[model samples]
Target: MKKTIALLIITLMVSPVYALEALSDDALQNVEGQAGADLSLKLSINHKLENDKYVFDNGTGAVCADVQFCRLAVSVNNRFIDNNGQASSGDGYKLWLVFKGIQGTINIQKLGLDGMDLSYKDDGGADKIKAAMQLSFDATKPIEIRNFGFNALAFGQDKFLTTAGVEAGSTNASDYGYLQVTRYDTSNAPGSVYDHGRETGFMGVQMNGNLALQGKVMMFGCDASHPRC
Candidate 1:
């Protein structure tokens, strides 16, 4: 029994020597490029949001209705290159809201700051984020969203948010908040949308288990000071 135990110990020690085989050239090539512990992406949304009628909030505090929703686009680039041609892993946000069907683009091009709340970018590698939501609804459309303004800055960044709809009494007042994990109804998620990593930080309203245009008002997120909110 003693001899058997000693032999087993010797065999265990020797096994590692045989197992130390070198990786072949093909195997090395398969993993030649090492990966950083971060993921980066850019976002540009379109066509999914467009209608034949709408309203507008023209910075001057005037609400314009009977408008046509021509285009609503927002692009965010993570690996942005500046004038110096040097690249930095940061958030660069751009937005365009065109109404009246090719009439004009709202003056929201340069959102608050170049490096503001980064929740607008890819969700990974973020330390902290703050979000401001501006919402409005048209009591007359299939999609109650007359205008939805969503903007967030991560890692000490700043941003701008605006929206359009009926008077103050109809929509929720301006409220500041922080971002949170939002689970989308993914049962009907399109394959293409999921494959490209499309995500939204906002939640929508529904009526009686259906999409309806009622006077329902709700918001997501937490108090700006709600520790890790």
Candidate 2:
């Protein structure tokens, strides 16, 4: 009995399953965002990113998506504001879009505007990139982007991903959205200020303003290239 008990203990100690179970609680906690600011996160499950049909709306105001995937669009506007209710105009703000829960492999064919142009030719199966709010997983952090846009983000599964958009409201608060925002104030930093989201598999951040953003805590997993999804 003593020998059998020792053998069982040794077997459990060397198991990969045991190693996964040994992950620290803090490791899990690392995925959750801080408690101070309100964070809006959306993650889709089983969806693939497409580059040809996705579009940026530019806030031109014309029921923009008058068409379907052939002309689907999302309007984005940005500007700066100070602590004392002042709006800083002139190509004012930066916009970022977040993608979470991308399993398998993600190939970003286009990175929409604000300083980073999406191009599959450039990334070529690169695991991760952080150009704007789009967390391609490169650089491990989001880069502040200005003057770039995208047509669409293509993925394999449509139902597996969630998207979260954050409009930092005045006073350091934030607003969350899934599909779109009807009307938001772009005046004197007194409106929805910051915007961003998270993907379960990864998260990205881009600082267009000097708002001092922080790291995002996330919960995500991935399936390696294999026969069984």
Candidate 3:
């Protein structure tokens, strides 16, 4: 009985060792991933990010423009993760869009901007980025862009240079029509003012062609009277 017991124990340990080897030698798997869709974000650039607080609606006491300043800064913050486990971790995705005031005005019937599609999988630890149609911009690095431009048509033949533009007054904050322009005043304030000079009008962006993105943004308030929006 003792010898039988001893032989059984040996077999149990040795057999597991072989099983471990088999698991290690197992074939590699073809991990298939799901494709991504075209995602969009439409930002309603409303208020001025001031040093004191956000100023909106025909700004006064400092930052003010045609009714108030119309230019602003927008961005997308994200991170991209690569596959390979502990060996290689991941990467980061960040981008910024700065708007400069406009000069001459011109209406665009349609403007098609290109974008990147990201494919990924939940690889247990973190989301792995299988592939990306276009690469993401690195937030940490400073990428210089030249001849970056945008413009709009205000009345008829009047032209305006700008970083970005939108129609005024949409309950949601962004409109798809109407064009804006530029002119900087020395009068200084901490940030961009909204609805200062005049009440905000609908930014009729769709007729010209949807900036291709639309959604309501939750700011403390808006480029209007209410700040807690």
Candidate 4:
């Protein structure tokens, strides 16, 4: 028995082992494969009214006291150049596009990444792979947006700036600013004074539905080869 165990140990110690190495370009071209991936996502941005104020749940069993609702704000800077090829003083201004009170649940059952393909193009007498990623999405599951809404759309200059410099662009009376469209009291006669003392906002929208989409989106790099790149 001892001799048998010793023989087995010697065989294992002398056995040859192979290490993995990267495949060459020629070898990689010969390899053919196909695969897909599935994704499930659920997003929610909601708020509740309490004590005449709006509050949001922070997902940790506590209310977010600092701000209300899920907000997205984008600011664009416009600069004007003078005849001397320099930026003119006080000629530059900023425009704000704010979407407030975003409340919705975006549920995607199965977002599929079907496959990827490589496209080749001729460039300067040589064949080269295009600098792009071509992907396809399967339409097996439809995307759902439930109770999606926003309280206001603020688009204008910096009139929404508060005393503390924080942006106040919501429909609230205290934070109301320029270029806001609100609901007016049209219940009275048309000739009577239209009461514009309701809410303040540029626009508001609420929608609920399932969107069916299935297609391929190609993301590519910008270069001189393509005129519209």
TM-scores of all predicted structures: 0.13, 0.14, 0.18, 0.45
lDDT of 3: 0.30
Window of ten residues with lowest summed lDDT in model 3 = 155-164
Clashing pairs in 4: 181-201
lDDT of each: 0.30, 0.30, 0.30, 0.55
Q: Candidate 4 lDDT, tens digit per residue, 9-104?
A: 999999999899986534555666676567788886675445844344435654322223355567544433334445533342235476755666
Ten contiguous residues minimizing lDDT sum, candidate 4: 158-167
Instruction: Write one digit per residue (lDDT tens) for candidate 3, span 1-229.
Output: 9999999999888884433433111121233345433333322233343584433333455333452144443533231222321221123221224343321222222222323323333334444322223322223232322112322212211121111232122343222112233333434463734433322333312112112222222212122222222
Q: Native-vs-model 2 lDDT?
A: 0.30
lDDT of 1 by residue, 83-186 (tens): 44454444221122211211221212111111112233223444444432323333333322223332212221112222221112223211211111122355
lDDT of 2 by residue, 24-101 (tens): 424543444422322233232232335732223322342333212222223344333323335433232222342321
What's model 1's TM-score?
0.13
RMSD of each: 26.8, 22.7, 25.2, 11.1
